[model samples]
Target: MTRKQRVLFLCRDNATLSILAEALLRELDGLHFDAFSAGLEPADRVHAAALGELRHGFSSLDLLNPKSWLEFTSEWAPEMDFVVTLCDESARVDVRAFHGTPKLRHWTLTPSAHGATHAIENAFWQILKRVEDFIAAERRPWPSSLKLPAVASCTTDACDLLLSGQ
Candidate 1:
């Protein structure tokens, strides 16, 4: 089976844009991708407004604690397939040194400079729109007669027994 794609969303802090991107992608089922978010330097907590915006469309369960990019390259490293940077500052640096050779993309958003409520919400929605477009593109169907393995399927003995004509 082909491996499921692993995507990491990054920003200066794992607080706003990265957090929302992770949550939004989770709500999109057909994309068949796993999402994670981290930062160069993390904050104490996710920004309250960002969390609230995410809650409107997704469950708050498994919400990420703020963490550094350093953690992803250590012994605890996750095998990443894509790495996306969501802000100008984080996008400008070289993340490959830490996240390995995952395909990298940048989606730059204006920073929440003054922390104005409406501005933050606007930025969130803008990012959300971009993410939606990305998911749609990724979900496009393969050509007919192509025999790709289902990477998302279970391989456990119980699953095998269930699928058998027993």
Candidate 2:
């Protein structure tokens, strides 16, 4: 059997965007992907608003927790197939390379300027859209030459559509 592709999502704080992406991908395609999330500097707990948004879509959230990216630096950590940064801050943080040399992609999503709960709710939908698009792209056949570019290095709007594997 083909091995599941492992993906890690990173952000400044593992409170909202990264958490949502991890849960959405895991619930949507656990058979094909192993999803994980960590922050450069993790919060003490998952944000309450994040948990509330997740409750609407996920029944089993026992595993969700805010953790440091340092946790994945250990030899015991699974080799990631992809490392995705959800925010600009995370994409800029200098860090040691992942063991597996995973493809790096940045999905530039910012929480809405609205109040906390509304912001988390908005981020949930945005992340869910990207998560679903990512899954669909992963399932399609692609030529080896068309592998995803290092989107984290791309600082322009031109790279936005690349997330859809277009």
Candidate 3:
């Protein structure tokens, strides 16, 4: 079977944009992508409004949680095909664990940290829209005839290089 491409969304907080991006891709393009999210310095908890907005479409938001990027540097972390930074604060990230030089894309956004309720909700929806467009644009029909080996057995760098189309 063809393997799904893996994507890691990152930010400074991991509580809003990254979480929402991960959840949105998993819910909408689960067949094409394996999505994950993390932050450089994680917050104590995910933003309530982001969770509430996501719950409107997804059956469950159980997977959404604040996480640290350091977790992905471990050998046990999943090999990623793409690394995306969603907030300006985390636009420049070090991605050493991913196989090869995975595609790195950054989308900068401004968060009204202390702004009104509407601003926070707007950020959630805006981020969701950007993530949706990104995944949708990259989504493609897997070559039905192409046979790939089990992803678990591949070396981290090899897996990333293979996905990089090299």
Candidate 4:
């Protein structure tokens, strides 16, 4: 059997977007991917709206904790196949290459203000859509040598190309 690929999602704070992405991706395609999320500066807790939405939609909330990006830098951490930045702040942070030279993708998303139910809901749906597209791309059959250009847009075709190593 082929080994599962590891994916790490990042944002400025792990409270919302990154947390949603990690859980959504795991719920959507856990068999093929080990999904993780971390933030540059982690919050004390996961955002209530994000957690509540996830609790409503998913069976498990075991992976919903906010965590620091440093956790993934340890020698013992899983080597990621892909490292995705989900917000502009995280995408702008300059850092050395990740372990295993994981392919990087940026998904620019707006963070909702605290307690804005509608905004959080909007972000959740956006993240869910992106996660689905990412799964589809990873599962598609493509030539190994044909790398697509890495576009900043989160369109389905762009996601497929981004993960194919641009």
Candidate 5:
């Protein structure tokens, strides 16, 4: 079986955009990828409006409490295949090289500093749709050369199930 791709989503607070992306990707399942999220400076809790928006596309279990990027560099953290930054601030930072030598992608989004709750939710939905599209287009045969872990086997099945549902 082909290995699952591990993806990490990063944002300034790990409260809104990153959390939303992580949940959406998780809902897509184990066929193509597994996802996690973190922040440069995490918030105490995720934004309520963002959580409400995610409920429409994913399960609550997929939404994580805020965490730091430092955790992923630790021995206990999962080795990621891709590390994505979903906020402008994180995109500007240069700390793209993490422990597992993951490829980095930037999906910059405007922060919802002044928008209405509904508007913010809509923005998240749009970003998630884009992310889904990227994942679909990028699916490929797993390479034998990449030194991956055992858990990566879920990538194909989860990604397939996720795309099929959409």
Candidate 6:
């Protein structure tokens, strides 16, 4: 069997978008990836709204915590195949600490989008959808199947998760 790819999702705070991206990617397809998240400057505490949104949907996600990008500089951090920035602030900053060799992608997930309790939930759902979409696009599209296989796209749990926030 082929080894799974390691993907890191980064944001300024690690309190919201990056956390959602990492968890959602694993939830969508654990067999294909090892997801990680970190922030340029981690908050002492994770944003409550972020955890609330996730807990209400996924039954298990112990990795949902704030972490500093600094930690990834050490030898312990997993080698990343892809590094994605989920916020504009993080996307603009240099991330040479990972030896500057990994592939990178950017998605705009502004803090402004999660301004309230309901919006916070919506933001999580949005990030989840975006990450799933990113994975689908990255895979070699089957020639006969110009569209990604529905089974491999959004799953029922994802639908429930997104709808739960509504």
Among these predicted structures, which one has the highest TM-score? 2
lDDT of 2 by residue, 45-160 (tens): 98898888878768558888999998887888888888899888889754456786787889977647223777888888889899999998885333356554464566456666
Q: Residues 91-148, candidate 6, lDDT per residue (tens digit)? A: 8766677854778898876566655767887787678778778888764333353553
Off by over 4 Å in 2: 94-96, 110-115, 140-166
Q: TM-scores, in order shown?
A: 0.75, 0.78, 0.77, 0.77, 0.73, 0.74
Winner by lDDT between candidate 5 and candidate 3: 3
lDDT of 1 by residue, 39-82 (tens): 88899988888777766657643666788877777866887877
Cα displacement (angstroms), candidate 4, residue 153, comes to: 54
Worst 10 residues of 6 by lDDT: 140-149
Tens-place lDDT per residue, model 4, 39-77, is 999999988888888987686587678898988988888
TM-score, predicted candidate 2 vs. hidden true structure: 0.78
Give the C-alpha miss distance for residue 97 in model 3, angstroms: 4.7
Question: How much is the lDDT of residue 97 in candidate 5?
Answer: 49
Model 5, C-alpha of 141: deviation from truth (Å): 4.7
lDDT of 3 by residue, 1-166 (tens): 6789888999888887788888888988898998999999999998887787776769548888899988887778777888998766677676665656678888766656324556667777677778788877888788778666767677889979989999
Question: Cα lDDT of all candidates, in order?
Answer: 0.74, 0.83, 0.80, 0.82, 0.76, 0.77
Show how many residue pairs clash in every candidate, following the order shown: 0, 0, 0, 0, 11, 0
lDDT: worst 10-residue window of model 3: 111-120
